[model samples]
Target: MEENQLNPDVDYTDMLSICSQALDFYQQHGITELIHAFNIANILGTNQFYAEAAFFYKVAFNMHSKSAGQFPLAHFLLMARLVALLKGNFPIKEDEMNQLKGLCIPLYNFVEGWKRYKENGDALSAIRLMGNCFEEFHTGEEADTIYLTIMMDLFNPNPEICIKDRTFGAADFNVIPNNLFMYWDQNPPAEILQNFEYHKGLTHFNLKIFDKAEAIEWLYQNYGVEARQIFLSARHPAEAADFLRVHVINYYGGWWLDADIKIQSIDKFCSIIPSSYEHVFLLTHNNVVHNDFFGSVPNSPILNDCMLSLYRNSYLHTGLFIAYKTGPGIFGRALNRTFYRSLRGETKKPSVVLLNDRKFWSVIADFETPYKDSTPHWQAS
Candidate 1:
């Protein structure tokens, strides 16, 4: 008889039993499967089968060391460290503590690599881990400051030692000066000064000192191309709204042009597009009710009327926005005030008041503006 002719009826209970047996087998034998067990233990503490989970993690760690060498050590170390920390306040198991201690160098090295590469996300992650470890070790603020300073040096834009090959090129034209650069020449931190010789060897681009118009013209003339200009002006809504208007016009010399925009072409879009309008174009798919993307719009009677209404009602959102600027005018002050009031918690109904207004705003609301999300990006903090 053919095997197909002898087909048996399916049994749900047997199938479930088989699945349970397989899961049990996996739990008993599979080292890779322990990550899930560790995660579960992390979420649900030792009182709820976490001891078993920790045991599984330990087994997985040992298996990883035996099979993959030190490749998986960082992950296992982090997991074990978290478990040890959580189960603490008393003396931990000596072997477990030693294992956690062993992870410190590798973790620190990983963080150092991130800082050197200016990987903002990784740097932040490393900082978080360092902070946890510091707390566990009761490390003093002085040690923390040293660690932070070291990390900052790894990512500093203006190091004293500028290697010729490492100098800023045309591609790095948009790199903005950070607090590190501003303080480097004045009260050079010891960490930065140590690498000053290396920074000096690298070429530098001084955007603030260079003639921007000439630079733009030169790039166009020599390279047969035009570069987009982006002016990042960040401030408290009360102060920055006024400053952004002057900055944009001064940088671009009051030229308006329509250009193709892509999702990734934010700087390019902002440069070619005119800011003198009620609705400034954005290089994002997200909608905005106000032009907060450019910081502030030109002042106008319409905006003045809206400002008057908001002031009379004592309403604000303290949200920054891109504004519509047709010519030299200060029409968006009310919107700025609105945002300032909202931020100060002076406005009772922030979201409804600022975002619901349709007369003075556009599709983009003040809250809808896309601010920089990266750690190294511009911010007052």
Candidate 2:
């Protein structure tokens, strides 16, 4: 009969017969039956056919194991073993454990080789293989242990890795002090911090502004008086201001800039210009369109509330401000306490003195704008 003559409403038995014939024809054509069998096993497993699915999955896994190395086949075999164990058909054995351990040795070796190649800048092939490795073997505590071991080995180099390019190093990049102050609570990855510090640039650590009193003390003790000058901020306003005071008292006096404001370049603008107001800079609302960025200061009753109101009216950003040590005083402490209280929802109103009248904070810019090269800067509202 012509193929087009076949009825759409064919009976189940007729469909089964046709499918069986087609499968047999494919098998006779030397097509690998393993893939079909593996697919069938998955379908069966999905349909709760545990015993049948385990048998087919094992068949597929063994076929692959013989052709591919054990590492490449581990995922399929592991799944097969899991399914068998779930069905009570397979049990953990000494021989099976040995096989798994053997597989792991090569996987670790592979990862180490990749890491070495990556360090030497000859990692094209190794980098390509990393994805496969992660996908296949990211399982259980054994994998975790292997990863940790590899990382430890890589990082424990005697000479340590160095960047060949100096421009990307801390020296070339202009590190803003403001950025450092803002990220006071940001703890970057250890590797990142190490790289930055190796270049003698700004590095960061995250601390619970309220709870890290001991850590703060420890840092001071280890790094000495110079380390006390490193800028930091708290997640909450109250905590940040309090932390600032604590450091101020210890360091004698240092500047504290809110994180939200971004400076174009403090080194070029402030460092080069030597004036009596060198210690002080004019802060204006970011949205103020006046030719002078810093025109007038805002005097609001409730500082936080005024900040919120100014933010609402002139659309001025409230977070940008610089606080310098003008002889020891209670103003810093009071601001810190007020900020804390406002954050805790304790105060119905916020008391923010508008430093500038230009309507908005200057730091507001595109998300990807680079605030500083090597220096720490603020990223506030």
Candidate 3:
């Protein structure tokens, strides 16, 4: 709920006051700008005023859809409207619901498909409906994001579709390397170091910690200068970590744990992934795949997609939210693309396993990160 949202640079606290003033202006003089309407919706949405956000989002959508051709941003606003409606649990009018269902738009079709799934509890149908939307759109950015949002929403109602269990045998462990990696920018506090040592003691894997200098050098050596440059261009240390973790795991074929992450029971943790599994990661109760901790075999297609996402988003969206650019945004979209392709028999389904919250928390307890106050975390950044 504390997500940085579309643009964190906006001061929502000040915008909330401006939003009220604008509403008053609209009521009295009927003054409204298209950009203002969209900004109001974004502020309200980030503040969790979903019902009001939906109103402004609709206004923005209507304005853009009518004023011009089908620009992609207009569709994004439409998607936002549905998300606000869904998140707020606001009742849709019978006439509006009918209108949404009758529209030839792919987004509307997807929303109607979601409604059907809500009624019938058919997970595969909902997935296929989302897949159909993906097939229609060849572009990235907002289109891929719409797919990610829909996929996240679907996981909540049909939890069974998201969980993947991997029970590794003794022989299974031999194939996958026993390397565990974590990174810190520099000057790790004693508390963080203690946590690192504790995890190292618990697991048999060769735990490797990389400082900022070492991380940059490793990226340069393995991924070449372009990768190193991306790491340098990162606005924050954590963002740089996002770029590095995937590359390291993809090349080395092992586990990458965030510096803040602490494993509770090594026995339970080590038991999760089997040798045959190409990818292993944890999914939160909210259905986001955690980039903080994950494992993969060498040259995983999923991680390759993640690396590509980092480069593409860096070039295309210079200042996008880190989650969407280098974090779970790309992670979830890659999974959906892989899964959808698998459904069509276009490619082999990747051997991916997602540990649910129940399974994930059993071997790991959440700890207050030492740099919680000092570092600019994604939500605040």
What does candidate 1's lDDT look like per residue over 1-381, in tens digits? Answer: 011111224222332233444345444643234454344334333333334434445544544533335544545434453353334322235555455456665444433433433435444445434543322221121222233333333232221211223243355112212111111113333443434433234333121211234434433453333121211122223222223233332233221111110112323223333322332222222122223233223333234434343322222322322122111112233333333344346763221111122222222222221222422322342
| Cα lDDT, all candidates | 0.31, 0.34, 0.68
Model 2 agreement with the true structure over 131-232: per-residue lDDT tens digits: 223323321112222232233233222212222232323342122122222223354445434433432332222212212454356447744543333323
Regions of model 3 farther than 4 Å from truth: 1-32, 43-49, 62-72, 88-104, 132-175, 271-276
Runs in model 2 deviating more than 4 A are: 1-183, 189-215, 218-238, 258-262, 271-274, 278-281, 284-381
Which candidate's TM-score is highest? 3
Candidate 1: residue 370 Cα off by (Å)? 22
The local lDDT score (0 to 100) that residue 53 gets in candidate 1 is: 38
Cand. 1 TM to true fold: 0.22
In candidate 3 the C-alpha lDDT for residue 229 amounts to 90
Worst 10 residues of 1 by lDDT: 255-264
Q: Would you estimate the TM-scores of all the predictions?
A: 0.22, 0.21, 0.77
Count the clashes in each prediction: 48, 34, 0
What are the per-residue Cα lDDT tens digits for candidate 3 across 1-381?
Answer: 222223324333433454674455444533145666676677677777887788777767666644335553666666677768776877655665555545536766666666666667666777676556753443233445445445544433333333144454564322456788999888888778887888778758888898889988999998899889989899877888888888888888888888776777755665644345567767777567888877888888777877777788888876887887788777876777776676788987567666666766765667776667776677555
Candidate topping lDDT: 3
